[model samples]
Target: MKAVYINELGGTDVLTHGDRPEPEISPGEVLLRVHASALNHLDLNLRASNCRRFPHILGCDLAGEVVQISPDAGTDLKVGDRVLVDNRVKCGGINLCEHCASGNDQWCARQQRIGVDRDGGHADYVVAPAINAYTIPDAMPFTEAAALPIAAHTAWHCLITQAQLQPWDDVLVQAAGSGVGSMGIQIAKMMGCRVITTAGSDWKLDEAKKLGADAVINYRETASISQAVREMTDGKGVDVVFDCVGADVWEENMLCLKPQGRLVITGVTSGSRSSIDLSILQGRPLHLIGSGGRSRRSMADVMKMVNQGALHGIVGRTFPMAGVAEAHQAMHDRDFFGKLVIEH
Candidate 1:
């Protein structure tokens, strides 16, 4: 099997695309012939840090065909079935953990991440617990399905689950050019909410409009994000602010929200360190949420939306598996509006 992996933590120079032994599935697992995988910031972060395993495969979102299943897997899946992996392990099975039993599996202490803790997609083949693999619609392209697991799931978790967005709310989505940011706009719009989004470039803002953003702001050119958002909302501010960029826009996020408005953050693409004025929280009584563990249940909810055609994956660009290094560079450059996929 050919894969993009790292033997040491460093820059893209350490990303090696070559042949590796095909992974063998254990009990309760299934082997997949990977068709496509999508890149995430987590891939870059793991590529630069120590890994639990060497030659670590670096893709978090995968869509593929089932080739083999362990006899004890006890799954309805069969060979040739198309599926997308959930990436989170130890969330289900007969012996449910305390968290899983209570439907709070996101907090399962023994949970492991595929691209981070174990080998992941980004290769011609990968293996995952059958429970983590969900069948995708036959009409969905592999590249599009590959773009959904992390980006769409995270966005769904932040906006729908965490923020509890309402149809009548005016929403603010920060960094509209990002994968989660773009998905957030769609989710908000699907619920009949008015979406206001921001990006650093005009072209990206234009794309955001296509995704149902009611208003777009070029944050790079804007003198004040809060002031612009207020103007769009008749000086009332948005009822919810969904942010992926952190610290640099933290203060602005607070200012863009209405009193008792909710703000949910899932990423820190910029620097993460920042101090909040306690007085502001007291004065406004706002909801400041930090995106914590994501669960299989939420991932399943996202897939429901995808299957119903209410939501779709946003693929900004696609690269052949061999070009994994170039994909990493593009992610670092932040040149794409949505996911950067690697086709096997």
Candidate 2:
């Protein structure tokens, strides 16, 4: 099979597109003829080989059809059934691993990402555990289905599980132009919360508003959105703040939260350290929640929402697989809003 794989890691040049032997399917695993695959910022980090194995194919979000199933080990998956690949891989059983015994597969003591720690879907075919492949509704497009496993699931983990977001709550979402932030705004609104978002320009803010953000800030202009949030809430800040931009916005996020409110973080896109006056937390009694992808049930629930048209896929552009370098540079330079994909 022809696929993109990295033999050594350093820069984009390391992401070489070439042929490799087809992967051997294991017990309870099925072969997937991937129709579409999407890229995320994680691809860049994995490409550098900073955290995962070498000679790895870097991609995870995918939609495809089952071509072959392991008859001896699996139950009922068959050839030609349309499916969406779930990226969260688990290890261990029973008391062997605390994470798995608790049913949090994504946090298993030794888990592998579909495209990070293992071979991914940036190819004509890939193998996934039958349990990780989901049947996508015929009405849903493969492209959109491939986009949901990460950002959408991350948003679900944040607003629903982590922050325990409630209806009619006023919530602030940082990095509104980001793929997760784009979906984050929509998820908050779906829960009936009034949404406020902050980004670098009105252009990104416009997209944020269309995604149901009640208010959008051109962060480059205002210099301080905490005041805006306070004013909007009658001198009280919002109930929850969803932030992934990390240190660059920590202080503002601190000021933007209402007393006893929560802030859920999933990543540190900007430089990791920034000064914060500890007094803000002392005064307001804030709570911070850090989250990542969720369990299979949670991922499936969010994807079902997308399959039903409740949440729309916000793809900024689709670049060919050969344009891997450009895509990586664009993500690093912050050149696009929403999900930037590398299509096979």
Candidate 3:
């Protein structure tokens, strides 16, 4: 099998595209012929830092056809089934731990992500636990299916599960050009919330508005995003603020929320270190939530939306599997909006 892997994590130069042994399936596992894989910031982060193992393949969002499955895999899927991987590996793929049994696999003590802790889908072939594979709609393209798992699921978890966004609520999404940000905007709007989003460029802002953002802010041109949010809402601020950009927008996020409002955070693309003002927090009594991977149930719900055409996949660019290095460069440059996919 041909794969894009790294001998040691550092930069794009470390990414090696070459032949590797095909993965062998274990009990409750399935070997897939990867057709498409989407790139996420997680891939870039893992590539820039040292990994637990060398020759690591970095990608989580995968859509592929099942070529082999363990006899005791306990799934209804068969050899020719087309599926999308959930990316959140749990209990070392055992799926019998307390967290797994309770539908909170993301909290499992032995939780290991597909791309971060193990070899992932940036290859012609990959293996994943059967439980993490879900059959895709027959009409869906592999590239679109590959773009949904991480970004859409994360947005679903943050907006619906964590924040419990209401129809009347006004929401603010940071970095509208990002995968999660773009998905968040669409989800919030679908739920009947008025969405306010931020992007660095005017064209990106216009794109965000097309995705249903009621108001758009160009952070590069604006001095203070929080003030802009207040002005947009007529001094009331937003009921919820979804922030993936970290320390760089931390303070502004706090100020953009209405009193007693909720703020859900998923990623720290910008540096994570930031100081908080205890006085402001206590005065407003805000809710600050840290969200991680979504539950399988949540992923299923979001996928249902995709299948019904209520939610759409936003793919900004596509690169061949061998061009994984160039994909990383595009992500770092922030040259595209929505998700970037690697076709195998």
Model number with the top TM-score:
1
Better of 1 and 3 by TM-score: 1
Choose the strongest candidate by lDDT: 1
Q: Each candidate: what lDDT?
A: 0.91, 0.82, 0.89
| Model 2 regions more than 4 Å off | 49-52, 72-76, 92-96
TM-score of 3: 0.96
- Tell how far residue 205 is off in model 1, in angstroms: 0.8
State model 1's lDDT. 0.91
Which pairs of residues collide in model 2? none
Question: Tens digits of per-residue lDDT for model 1 on 1-344?
Answer: 89999999899999999988999998899999999999998888888875668978888889999999999999999999999999988854678889888889888878998888888898899999999999999999999999888888888888888999889999999988888998999999999999999999999999999998889999889999999999998899999999989999999999998999999999999989999887888889799998988888788888898999988888999999889999999999998888899988
TM-score of each candidate structure, all chains considered together: 0.98, 0.94, 0.96
Model 1 error, position 314 (Å): 0.8
Tens digit of per-residue lDDT, candidate 3, span 199-316:
9999999999999999999999999999999999999899999989999999889999999899999989898999998888878879998897567778779878887888777889
Whole-model alpha-carbon lDDT for candidate 2? 0.82
Output the worst ten-in-a-row residue range by lDDT, candidate 3: 88-97
Clashing residue pairs found in predicted model 3:
none
What does the lDDT read for residue 253 in candidate 3?
95
